[model samples]
Target: MAEWLIEEGIGESRAILVEDGAIVEAAIELPGALRPGAVLAARLAAILIPGRRGIARFEDGSEALVEPLRGTLAEGAAIRAEIVREPIPEPGRPKPAKCIVTEAPLRPAPTLRERIGKSSIHPPVGPDRFEEAGWSELLEEAASGEIAFPGGALRMSLTPAMTLFDVDGALPPAELAIAGARACARAIRRFSIGGSIGIDLPTVPSKAARQAAAEAIDALLPQPFERTAVNGFGFLQIVRRRERASIPELVQWDQAGAAARALLRRAERAPGAGPRTISAAPPVISVLGRNPEWLEELGRRIGAQVRLRPDPALAIAAGDVQSAHS
Candidate 1:
């Protein structure tokens, strides 16, 4: 039976669904994000489209794009809104968080544990259950946007419009299409990716081959998603409800922060226990420095002092944790 294994790590929380000793789905939740389902008290900042859409400024000064505004709601008028989607980070400008006017009481966003519920298993800190289940490998895939499967590979790219996957390999066209479609479907689920998605499979002239490719996606991906039929160009489009940021979006948005959090996770499990030293790039060190509380919690959990060493030569993702005496 599939089970969710959760790790409440420093600065972030991670969960993976494991079946047959392999991960099928993964999710990571970072702190302080305005997650979906959070109802907030806000004032109408501006009406971008009269009686339809506008920007709402929350109490914290954070703003979200709100829609379906009532005709009577004027600028600076107080109203309640429920977040529908977290802010999407794009190249130049980030798309603001999306919300709809609501009468729901203002409430804090749900934490990962709260969202996942009590049924998920939370493993003790000593053993790295996440690592054993290929957590690092999954992160690499999210960072690089490359996923390999049996016959082919999918190169994922995040764009302002949609997330796209381009399939490539040495397999025959028909076989590659089927395999790629399946792999793309799995990648979408594994990464908790949603919103609009496009997949480019190897072009197979035969209609039967195209049908097989489409069916492969149907077999792997669950419901609550709509997908277009594979066109002659072997392109398929999928649309899923997007709530929070996907793993790729989170990892890529703040590379240094991601590295720092990942290093802290390793530091928590680092053996020997005299003192833990994290040697990382300057930006990663800066991220850790900003979150002194996270470091303090790590020290408390491990019963040892934690230190940071910034090495300019080290890559952000290549940070290492070591015992002082080792």
Candidate 2:
């Protein structure tokens, strides 16, 4: 049995390296603010980055390969000490991933609905500093085919003239753009998204193509939508009204990693506890870029307990949620 650490609401997890299938011998080292998961990640999973990797001691005492944890893993509650399998070695070193092992107990934070539940909203007007730091495991889940949430299902299409979203619910469509060349006068309302969002739509060849898609999106826009732009890389440009302390885009995260010195002590500790439970969630890990299933497997290996929640839906800000009510 091992310890598994999972992030709240997001689709990522992490594991710790255990000696002889035991975690007490694991040790972790991290750099930065001491979040709930800092110490364990450093010691147990030896999570250097996020991806599907494994570290197990062989019967002959040889170190095994790494496969990071990935995907949206949720359960009614944490399961401790259930026998699980170890993965085979990768043909080669694939790109690494992160395992963001974080979870703020529900007692302190806002309810999942309060955090993201929105019924409808207007589109955003302009761009704001939209940055968030997430573990590579999160990205992997988004990029991979085994993703529990579909990309199209999670993202919205925003035009400066209109905000476009399709919820399989009662609300109608919405729009904000007006034929181009104008900034929105006020902030567009936050649509009812579950949480972090990603988008994919038709490709636009020229400015005309941009507006054409906008027009089509606009025609369906009966309620109120926001604005969006596309980047040179063909990535959709989403114009979401910024949130307070959002997930931190363009962010960087990694497991604090283990000091070679720490290895000497790992042998003396308990199973899954990572040689030491410096903190409740000792092992701290993070993921960046794109990956899928990097977090789930990590949780299974180390046996960290996690309480999964639905992804954050689009939360209407105080003003918008209020205005939306009005």
Highest-scoring model, TM-score = 1
Model 1 lDDT per residue over 1-326, tens place: 88887888889989998888778888888766467888988899999999899999988889999888888999999998898888877668988899999888889888777887754666545566677788899999999998999877899999878999999999999999999999998899989999999999988899999999999999999999999999999999999998878899878877898999999888887767589999999999999999999999999988999999999999989999999775
Please give the clash total of every predicted structure, in order.
Answer: 0, 95
Question: Per-residue lDDT tens digits of candidate 2, residues 1-326?
Answer: 32222112123111222223322111111221221221122212233343443342222233322333332323221211111211211223322222232343322223222333331121112221011122233323222212222122222232223233322212111111221111111111111211223334333356655555445534533334454554332233334332111111111112112111121112111233421221211222122112224334323433543222222232111000001111
Off by over 4 Å in 2: 1-109, 116-138, 141-208, 215-225, 228-238, 245-326
Worst 10 residues of 2 by lDDT: 317-326
In TM-score terms, candidate 2 sits at 0.22
Q: Indicate which candidate wins on lDDT.
A: 1
Global lDDT for candidate 1?
0.89
Itemize residue pairs with steric clashes in candidate 1. none
RMSD of each: 1.4, 22.4
